[model samples]
Target: RDIAPSDVLAAREAGATGVVLEAGATNSHALILARSLGLPAVIAVAGLLSSVTDGDLIEVDGNSGEITIGETVPASAPVAAGRATPSATRSSAPPVTRTTDGRVVRLYANVGQTADVGVALAAGAEGVGVVRTEFLFLDEPPSEQDQYEVYREMADRLAGKPLVIRTLDAGGDKPLPYLPVAPEANPYLGLRGLRLSLAHTEVFRTQLRAILRAAVHGRIMLMYPMVTNAEEIALANEQLLAARTELAASGEEAGDVAVGAMIEVPAAALRAEALARHAAFLSVGTNDLAQYTLAADRNNAAVSYLYSQTHPAVLRLIQATVTGAHRRGRPVAICGEVAGDVDALPLLIGLDVDELSVAPHSLERVRAAIASLSYPECVARTEAHLRDV
Candidate 1:
């Protein structure tokens, strides 16, 4: 053992205690040397550290891989040998959207993968606000039935809860390697979402077929993203109708599915009232709204920090979109990273958002925050905070 000769010296100098060593690639000699020094030691479990982030005051249950942050109680906490068995706990309960008066607001998760569907439900999501079906069409494209199977599995797990599926939003940053899309210099400004899906008829047809197929099994709605004009909505409805016609010909009934669009771009946000006239609901993708509104590329690290959801201009647009949707009797939800921030929650509550979709990890913390503040206080505080920001 390399450190055997200096084990005592290391102890004296380093103030040694029980060492936690990663076993996968840890040097055996080092373990032996630490053992010689009479240091208590243990091997690191795979994936243990990966889940924990820096600056997170995390309570980790080694036995369950459960990590709780903020005020949320984790499902379980780690216990040492002979210690009392810890009661089952979760890092936090699912998040609740709060009104200014402290009324519970519906908060859901915008899931991308089937695996995430369970996580969102377990985290206390009211429903899956959004399911980007694009992930299903990656490489080695699965059959239409295969897509239906995945969607049905997720729908079954959600069990009567609202699940909004956005048909294949490919191209741009999410190009399919298998589908020969020529590299665009400005992919973000290029064809994507409903446009990409429509241009490629077979691709859009297959997705619509899969989604309609899954609709028979659950409470489902169809939504499109990156919409700019009314024609896109008209065209999208035509395609969906064609899908329904085809499914009926095949002896499969196309169940009722509400159609909607995302209000992300400035044009869409401006025309939200008109967009709502044609669609069932409107979801503001704040992530893209901020980027496109501020003319900032989120991926550009140089200016990424300047991306501010707190920007008054961006706030105005979001409020306008929410207000417009409500006026038209169309529900509005936000699916973005901002939904997870406790500070932003109040602002959102004040804005009268119908729902919020956030990451699973931040769910409980948000719930606790919501439970702590009344809607009036939240709005008052948000109003005051906006001035300072």
Candidate 2:
């Protein structure tokens, strides 16, 4: 799919009416390709298979989960009516909000629950960026079988699209009573993410094995949360190797897996250049970064407002983190509250962010926001904003 852009354009040039694709591939790369090719696309809801055929001339009603096939009437199964294709609706062409200049940006959504998949598609998200897999384990310490079932269900919903499955980020704010973690004076800065995973070796290994196992069914990327240093990333990878070795000994098969790190802690963000060399990719958890940098507790009402994404310090940290990752020729994405903020959205685009993974509810607006500006305008605004910060 490296030449996917040209492929799409060729299809349009050949007079193809519409196209259907998996959700994950619908990110900025795919979206830009679609716009450039002038081909209207319909992304499936909840990773459901789209009924559009090559010659169907089908109408994709994204808002209502409907795809109308040919014949005098619309086909019922997984197809509906009253839905306008994205390109069709935009044919009239209205002025949009872009960077102070004008370059299109791409936006995505981060999913968690089963329902989020459909919501994201309906919101016009190109795809899901990060799927926090810990929620699947929190209900009860999921047995290995239970983990497999949940992963399978998630994979099915994601279809053939890319799903960045972050291995369980236990302890701290999201503590599991079954797996006890000792209290710390600073829980936020405590043994969370890879640190906790390493301490609870069994839990860590189980989750890693579960992810690797699930990768067989769909396009999957493995991510480590709350990673602060290269050693932590190495330790997580070591445990992953251990899991694979154990599986191989058991004669079980594992699928392709890419190990990446979460740049949340200031330390991790600052060291992103070195860390990216080890990680396949990088994603910033701006919520925690904001809290950590501003000395504000996200859960505390007293200083919650101080946990501002627009703050100069917070923006600078994010810019630095993105710069560090890009310098290493690695792609980095943002999966934080700021990703959905309309005002902050432009700022992030300006910062040269590779992806903006936001909530499902904000997808269409975010995409439209990004589409309004050009890359050059965003870069200039981003530079000026960073300087002001």
Q: Which candidate is the best by TM-score?
A: 1
lDDT by residue (tens digit), candidate 2, 1-389: 12244355455546554556544223323333343232456653343344443335456553354666664433443433222233313323332324445543445567655656665555555556777665544556677666766766767776776678887776666666556778799877887777877888897788778877888887778898888889888888889899889888998788888778888898888888999999988888887788888998765545655767677778787788888889989888888767867777667876777877776655666666666666676567667777765
**Worst window of 10 by summed lDDT in candidate 1:** 79-88
lDDT at position 388, candidate 1: 48
> Which regions of candidate 2 deviate over 4 angstroms?
1-106
Regions of candidate 1 where Cα sits further than 4 Å from its true position:
1-100, 385-389
Clashing pairs in 2: 67-80, 102-373, 102-374, 103-373, 103-374, 103-375, 104-373, 104-374, 105-370
TM-score of each: 0.74, 0.72
Q: Can you write out model 1's per-residue Cα lDDT over 174-282, one digit (the tens) per residue?
A: 5665455676888888887788777777767777888899999999988998888778999998988899899999998777899999877888888888888999998
